[model samples]
Target: MKSLTFLLVFVPLLSVCRSQSETGVDEELGDEEHVELFTTATTKLAAATSDFGYNLYRALASQDASSNVLLAPLSVSTVLTQLSMGASETAERQLYRALRYHTLQDPQLHNTLRDLLTSTGTTGKGLSTAARVYLSRRLRVKPEFLRLVEQQFGTAPKQLMGGAKDLKDINDWVSQGTGGKVQRFLTKPFPRNTGVNTVSAAHFKGKWENGFSQSNSLESFQIDGGTTVRVPMMHQDNYPVKMGVDSDLSCTIAQIQMQDSVSIFVFLPNDVSANLTTLEESLTAEFVQDLSMTLLPAEVSLMLPVLSFSSTNELQPLLADLGLSDWLTSPGLEKITAQPVKLGTVNHKVVMEMVAEGNRYASSTSPPSHLALRVDKPFLFLVRDESSGALLLVGRMVNPKNLRI
Candidate 1:
């Protein structure tokens, strides 16, 4: 089965993260063409966000209500920061928006989100707690909403080739895209949804524009769970990295060139393996602003799932935790456009499914393959585009149950 997915790399841009009393802060002083490219990428990314928002809506619509499944959103920048301690909100959003563009590029995958949602029972929250109210009716319109997503994505879908290795490509792109907040999503068995088709891309890669020493990999390392993993940790010396609003937040990034529009980015929170939700919620544009204003370097130690993997999730409540107020059950899907009639409620809905396997592969009894690490907890993550900070696909693995794919 051909991998039906998208891919790209991410780069941070000069955008005002927070207003400063300083004079030159608001102005973006970068190569006009490069900035333009990032701008176009952002446009594609915003569209991708719309697509993922809708796709997630479908995923929520299909979930079994009894599971009490939920999802959470983290600013793309925060996770990248935690991973390697480097990146920006605009850059992270570009990563997310890219995922959206990737989805828009493929009609089969885009439409598939609807099919899987259409088959499930509706029971749960919407993108927002309020959105969940629309489940009954919205669930009925998944096919329609999905159609809307395809139409919204526009003629670009025609440009995508069905035979492309979508998941891997997308993952590679995202790795390069975010400088690597997301290293790899699924590489082994391509993640089986068991019930429907699902595709996910996760990646993080970089060589320290200055190249970290491989000798550092020999150091004894600290794993969040209290056990020490003698990791082959790579170290970058005296790297020019950024600091977040608080001294607690910091980041470092590695640029990956080639194959796909992607990069390898890492964020290092004050505490490695800190509670991600708290970390995400704690993120503020102002803090990011502070981060962009300063740069310094300290010895860095990194430990992550060195491989890719996948799972399943009921992401509604999880979304509620993040701040997506009304896309799901909020009377209607969240309004995409506002003509200023002061729209009350846009008819909205949500549904979810794990996109994995093909007609040929689904029927086979293949052994479950393995990657380097298992996603067992919540961590800020994304698979995004290089040109735009838009998230092609967004997720938080608060729990591995969501990794069933």
Candidate 2:
């Protein structure tokens, strides 16, 4: 029952959240103590996902060694200086939450993912079969998630929607569950789709021990493709920090650990935005060798924004990309049943979202994750693993239920 309750909590964390043509809601990121606790939540959730995804996300979480080819904006010496002041806590909290949302456990999302291997017959051959088999292991982690999806087949059926909610029920769940952080990822109103749809969502709220000084005002920034935009970047004079480099090639990464274990890493491109590629490419397990160990001290400055995202994508591409091709087809999937189970192949779909409270971007290509994607225009976001650095889920959400598994 406790396990089921945990799965229930992720539903409201919509990965891609759509701006509802309005913004002024009373949102709070909680106090520092509460914020620290989220780090614990994020770490546990990330671990759970790693187990369910079977290290698929673990690969992405790894950050590679820093290379000369990718000169960083900040030096190891400077980063270490900041770390000594104790900033890693904040970064850890952020990383933990991001990983949690990236972990994918929505009912609608599960349906789409389940289909990749839900073969009607035992033609289990190739990657499809493998994926389904691997995913079946999640039955225990997502007992309720499965039942909820099964329920979508009917109402309070003698069965649960794979023991999870149906696509139809997602809207109501998101509206109130996430403090309204997630609303309409579902495109359709109340109509239920005959096809099974898996669902996933995420919500994040955090406050800075110190708010941005409105006086910091506007700043000019360079982005990828050599474009520049005027952005209202936040300014934090001497934020807490942590840093270290185990070896030369193994670049030092600084962090701000939130209460539990979640953390944040700011990748400052030497050329502002030119190194965005490095930031992305270096976000893998093999590359993460340096980060797994080593610690140092440093002084810091921070720019962050308030961000929210919710999205939907076919699970095929993501799974295949993650070395789980064997599970994308029939016979590759698993049947989660007990009694006169009428259930067969299981497909999976996912949605994830998060929010940050801070500021800026190095460039257009590497848009500053300002923690502030104000509701000026309907925007998009993703909850990706801070470890393997893989995108657990992505979606452009206007409707919280806009799923395509």
Candidate 3:
């Protein structure tokens, strides 16, 4: 049997705030009503995909609780769902179940995804996503499947000749997709007996709505073993932000806006010695949606670390652990080609950097007020698209100095 490979890359952007008001109009109506129906479908699809991303992140974090973790769950779920279109009935069922899409009653999954891609890829938002499929040179793809993938996912299958040039082509394609932010995504050679491969990338470079001052100071960061390290921390006073405390999770949540309809929600545990396991496990699409609505607006002295890091992770083992072992072992993707193919490996890479670069400020050396919220310890953050309610990235920052995964 031949092996299929999946590659995903995500660069940092931000996240969204969701509204639950539903329109109760009938679907069978005029053009305006059709637009409303499409909007509703895409909204529901975004929520479903976000839930899948949260589940995948929890599974990945469970593997190594101490290490820094970063991933673009939306990109991963998008590529996998795109691949599922070519899967056989049994294989499709397993894939949908793993992705948490089996419970959705909507039949236009592909159409909804197309709408989502269009909505989130708006210009000037500093956010973009793309997907492509590559096939072994020997196998011939079905024309109908090619048309469907091209029309929905915006790319057709290409031939992989299994050489170094093929690797360069893949990397170049990824670089172009992410506007050169993510270059050389695949550093290693493709495995033997590779059959089909899918590549997806998302990139976003965002600025804060209320910019932080360029003048930053080194602050003490508390890590494990009763030790502390000084790191450059961006500071701003009297910043308008949504702040709240989740008693159930025992953490302080802060939502900061960016240029576009994007927000970054920071979850800082009340105790520096607290473990983020409980907070991480408690994240779901519905949970985050409700939590965003309840946060009260407040102005506080804010300090955030200058974070820039990237990680490359092999997700095959994680997916297998998440109850998709059979699908990976025998992914009947017959629609792509007549040849037998199984999922061999899944590779995911993420690059994120949040900096202070919106407005200039005069230098000031003053003590932080009592209402200051300094992110000086381990914390979790979610970058989302507020317009579509899509999760752009989910990350855990433990040791900023150590960027390796």
Candidate ranking (lDDT, best to worst): 3, 2, 1
Worst 10 residues of 3 by lDDT: 1-10
Model 1, residue 377: C-alpha shift (Å): 14
Candidate 2, residue 190: how far the Cα is off, in Å: 12
Model 2 residue 382 lDDT score: 26
Alpha-carbon TM-score of each model against the true structure: 0.36, 0.44, 0.85
Writing each residue's lDDT as its tens digit, candidate 3 over 233-290 gives: 8888877778766655778898888777888899998787888999898787766765
Candidate 2 lDDT, 13-80, residue by residue in tens: 32222122222232443322311211333333333333334232223222322211111011111111
The local distance difference test score of each candidate is: 0.29, 0.30, 0.74
Which rank order by TM-score, best down to worst?
3, 2, 1
Question: Model 3: what TM-score?
Answer: 0.85
- lDDT pick, better of 1 and 3: 3
Best by lDDT: 3
**Model 1 over residues 1-405: C-alpha lDDT tens digits?**
110111111123232232222334335653223122222333433444434443453345334322222232212222211211111333333333423433345434434333322221122101111111111111222344334434532211111112235445544544453334444433332222211112222222211223323332333444466654442333322332222222233322212211133222233334546644443443322222222223222222223332123333333243432333332223122222111111121111112232111122122133322211112222334333333333323334322222222
After best superposition, candidate 2 residue 350: deviation in angstroms?
9.6
What is model 2's C-alpha RMSD? 19.9
Q: Show where candidate 2 strays beyond 4 Å.
A: 1-168, 189-195, 209-216, 244-252, 259-261, 273-278, 284-293, 305-312, 331-334, 337-405
